[model samples]
Target: MTTEIGFVFAVLGITIALFISDKLRMDLVALMVVAVLAVSGIVTPAEAVSGFGNPTVVMIAALFVVGEGLFRTGVAAAAGNWLLKVGGGSEVRLLCFLLPVVALLSAFMSSTGAVALLIPVVLSMARRSGMQPSKLMMPLAFAALIGGMLTLIGTPPNIVVSGALKEAGLEPFGFFEFTPIGAAILLVGAVYLITLGRRLLPARTSEQQTDHCDVPGLMASYGVSGQLHKLVVQPLSPLKHQTVVEAALRSEHRVTLVGIRRSGTLLSSILPVLANTRLEVRDELWVYGQENDIERLCLSHRLTHYGSPAKEISRMGREFGVAEVMLPPGTPLQGQSIKEGAFRQRYGLSVIGLRRRCEPLDTDYRETRMEGGDTLLLAGSWERIRALEGRRDLVLLQTPAELGEIPVHGSRAPLALLVLAAMLVCMTAGWLPALTTVLLAALAMILTGCVSLPEALRSLNATSLILIAGMLPLALAMEKSGALAFVVEHLVSWLGGASPLLLSTGLFLLTSLLSQFISNTATTVLIAPIALTAAQLLGVNPEPLMMTVAIAASTAFATPIASPVNTLVLAPGNYRFSDFARVGIPLQLLALAITLVMTPILFPF
Candidate 1:
């Protein structure tokens, strides 16, 4: 039995390690794990794969579509602009202006994604105004995180918390039940960051860090898909010596010319140098293959991968695929993560890309958070995309509906507010189910053509849908194996009858650590149920305990691994894995302390 247990544990551990490593794609790993556990008899294949179809998972994807509409209408974009402009002076002025905006926007959009969109915007502003990017980036990251806590749909943690509550027979959280306290945390965090954070942070500007990595010279190097490179030669490359046809003759290996890297120095005076540019040894080649292919090709003939070869793909676009969408006013998705609300079944599209706009406009492209004015990069056809008809400002990149169709751009801002207010009222007065009310608003948007049904489908997220559905059996396995309970029993014993304060602190720290390694939703899913069980065993209202876990789970401020938004920025920001830690460690510690002190005070024993 112990051997079997060890085998299961080994498989689970390796699966989790692969997820954290992100070397193999997450979905592939999940599928592999499903097969492994099923073959191992830990679960049947059908049971292992059941999580892929959860309604909640579908709703999460749908929520992303709704966010797409909000982004298109310039709602989030406009708000982000207002925040930066409002912060236009001292760092103190900036945080005062920025923090609330970050929190408010994050209430409806992705904190990590929102921050990625805002970072470039804010950094540009900071540079223009003589402010340091270093000072602003950390604060920006923290604001995005705290803002996530403001609404049930704001972040995965809140959604997981709500799901756990429902599982425990208590009501799931309303859209803004935690807002009052969340706002407080935002304020306190902003104040803390503005006053003291700037002092300790590494003062690196976006320019200082990116474009030119440590391996500099010969322009920029990109992570190629395969070992084969597809580099374009600049006029600077001695490649100007010969024609493309001639270069192909001179090269031993078959050199296929595919694309051209426009010479930045020559572009000012000339047209874009097409792939016709002659080949020089130093000319940029975007190799199609990677590692082994490069080695074999290079060994057989002669060619370098680039000035400096990268072991992995860049962070910007490679971590995950990206998709784009437009938000029309009156859409219900304006304020949520796909996980909380579920968009896969609600809408048909899957979101893999995102973009946002702010002053000095981002055009909000590619992995940008759900700020208004974001042009989401969705993976769907135009027939599917054209469904988002009446979105205010967003234009689908892949136009299928009415290519020339302009959004109605009504005063849905007010209507949106009213809808939120009504949802709050329903939650407070017990007028309707929160999910039902939110779903009604979504349905109305579709029916009214504010967001066309096809458009809704275009905005759904396929990866998240798979994530939620695929991972559940694994979560269930832990429970059925008595793994979670056993872990909890040992943890309680480890704590040694600790006080609520100590337990809260412990839970917060542990969840934060877990979040850094796993999906925030995954972290919350496992912890929330455990927290409730622990509270019950300890004779306490599970509210505070659950809240502790939820807050900690969402507060993965220290690593890109902590949140998807952080990962989105990894490439664009030119950040290394450790960079997240540089900013995250202090922020995590402070957030943990705050959670410890605040949870018990607010929710009480």
Candidate 2:
């Protein structure tokens, strides 16, 4: 190997280690690779950074905004809702309905966005059906991968492979050129998942199931019945002039005050009792605890037993509810305490309880520092609880099922759908390049108020764009250093006497394995040229080999880290790394069989 090839390989090795370790962000790891390649003289500074200007990077970034427009306008959620309506509560029915629908949506927009939009819907289904989220989540993620095969714009890898063909002076693939094989794979995959593959998926429950405790559930689970009792304080009551803490309700009697009910209008009807809240004559204290303890405290304090507190509190639940909010990795709320972060004031939700690492804490959580993966039970008005869906800092893990409808952008659904359809027609009809069509669609989404500027900007995934840009140089370096040619020469030599099917299968397996560890787009960019070179050596058309590579690149189903779509579900599904391999290996084999059989027939050796 040449010295430059050695250097490039070294950088690649380190990058893979970083990716598997999960210690550094993938984009940052990719950027480090670029820096090493540039510093090591494998590529010049301009060439190293040239990927940032690549059309693939620009197009992918623009698509992020377009996908965001669909999400913000509730277009994606509407599709997910439709799946639930048709599938009802059957896991088999849901999986059958879910896989195809998600695949269809992914054909047009970002697969990652499709998965994100459907996660809540699928989780809702899983909870209602008593099925583990793990069972449904992997299927949701796998279907997205299969969906990318259904169209030219389905994924970046397809675009990269097509762009390579164009640059090679060959006629590029038509927009729907990928549909035949992609649809076949989607059909086979959907079948595999719902039937045999469904049996393979592990039944692991999510933290949202075990750790999310609302007020009613907590009360019932703890057997704290009849704990809520209202006591009326007389003028001569011992608690009349004391503050809540000074009254020693909790310290002396194990009784806790929930709120204070006073006379007159609704504004002063009930006030949330705080630490410094003072007690006064005729103040109705809503205390919760052992019935005997509360009665004893009431008698000792010259207080009169009043109405039922549990009934009154239960009525408050009509307008109030509890939700579980999770601080996922990369959330800005990490490292800040509840009090310091002003979470209650900012979100209008009170943090009533917290669970860290699946262990609930009885101690006050207000001063506890927030960490990634921490689940918090929040109490607030139903409206405010629902509004948490719009926030990005924390994920709303669960809400009342009644409030699960997709939030729309006010009569703009038709406009958003129209814009999407126009973009699709233009791209499919070859009226413009895919990049131009996506850019125009994104701009239209903003202009039509389907997405705001801030939302559009937020939608642009800097990590994905930068990762693509950073990894693009590795392909260039491999080509320039003759490393790519060297690898292809050996492969062709080994398979020289083999049939076309063997060569296609070999390429498919190689590409699929590499995609598991690296960005699939980068994997496609590297493997496409090699596959084409091998085709030339065998005196066959490069289209079949190239198509095999494209299909294989989308088979990133074998690892949680294989695709962003998978990573997005890791915490939500409570899946282990082994869970993916158990399910993905069989799917990969199935895809390989379908690709090897179909590519040769479609393109003909």
Candidate 3:
């Protein structure tokens, strides 16, 4: 290798190591490599930073707005209703119809987007049908992963692969070239999975219950602690006219009000802090009652409770309680031990059990790495858990029933879909660049108030942006350093006389393994350059090889650690860490075999 190339390779290796190890952010790592390249005269600084301005970035940013619009306007929800209506009553039927819809949507939308839309609908339907939310949520998430493979814009990995190939001077793939194999894998695989997965799938939704919790009964069950009983004020009742402090003495309740839940929102009430205002309807009021009078007050109000309502509570030391909180994605808790999180002290709760995506908590949760989908099995006072829910990692998971006349939402639903359809048609007709069509539609969405600017910003995953932007420089660094060629040559030689097909398959497998360990996007960027070089050295068309790379990279279905879809299911599926190996291992192997076989058939080397 040339001295210049050797230097580039060293920088590439270091950048990738820091990226995977997470010692540095991917963008920062990419920046460092770009800087190194410029210093070594491999590429000008202008060239290094220019990739950040690529139209792909603009299109992606706009898509986030579009996705947020669909969600905000309830277009996705309307679509979900129609889709589920068609799912029929049988589990297999639901899986067959719903999984394909999820996959197809995921092809152009975010997998998370698909899940966010589907979960609520599934949860609501599950309750109505006496079906399990757990049974459906995981399939929805998995379908998103499968469907994401259908188009270049479906998932970031597809775009990344196509861009990398384009840089190598190959004809970039058309919007639908991927559809033949991708759609086949999605359709056939969804069918195969619906059949086999039924027996293996569990029916657990962390909080799916026959009754929408009776707040009064729930509060009574948790057992009052420290002479304090937690409760919410009935709207426009006697308590509504008085402040917490005034209510206690005027009513001779002598209760120390500490918190309040109002209009389905919980707020901390400082009797002394904000006591001047009159009590409002829907406030979750936390009051410390006298040990003797507490029972009397409960009887007068006809109050009910959730945990052993019968148990008498005297002080904080004598009582513990339960509260339900939802886990959000990529939280620091997403893959840490409960012990490591210091969750016991942090939240003042025992690490009891978690309700994830509707599944019960597994036994090994203390040692089991916590991930986004698992709702924590918290044993503590309602006060503590309620406060904790306000944190970024958690959602209070409260949905009010008896909502009357859901404000007959306007035509935002139909209008949003129309806009999206028009944009796609324009893109297909080549009337606009894919970027322009998506961007214009996205801008129109913002104007319609379907999604506010703040919401759009929140929807953008900063980590994802950094990862994608950083990969550009890293790929260039690998190519410039000649390190990519070295790895390709050595890896090819190591496989020694393996047929082109077999070698391509082996490459796919290796990439798949790496993707399972890290972000699939990172895996694609890290290995794709090498695959291209390998294909050239082998005297074969690089199309099959590239297709193999794309397929291998996207099949991160086996471990919660491997793919977000699996991780999303871990808690909701009430899955053990090893459950991925049990269920996912087989699915993964199947995905790989299908992709390897299909890639060559569709795009011959």
Candidate topping TM-score: 2
Per-residue lDDT tens digits for candidate 3, residues 569-601, read: 444354544444455556667777777787878
TM for every model, in the order presented, reads 0.48, 0.60, 0.49
- Residue 209 in candidate 2, Cα distance off native in Å: 9.4
Please write out the lDDT profile of model 1 over residues 1-605, one tens digit for every residue: 35555666676678667765667656566677777777777677778877665555544444454444443333443444455567655677877777777677677755644563355356445533556566676677678888888888778788788788887898677787777667777777776787766665655555434432221111111222232243444434444567544444213333323233343222111001322355554444443333554455554435444623443222111111212455555445555543332332333344433334512222211223354444443322233345554544445433321122123333454444344345345533546654455466556555544455676786554543454455566665765665555655666777637776777877787788767655677667777876787777778878888887877877777765455555434433434445567667877777777776677787889
lDDT scores of the candidates, listed in order: 0.55, 0.74, 0.60
lDDT of 2 by residue, 474-505 (tens): 77786788766676567767876677788888
lDDT value, residue 249 of candidate 2 = 71
Candidate 3 local lDDT, residue 110 = 59
Q: What is the overall TM-score of model 2 with all chains considered together? A: 0.60
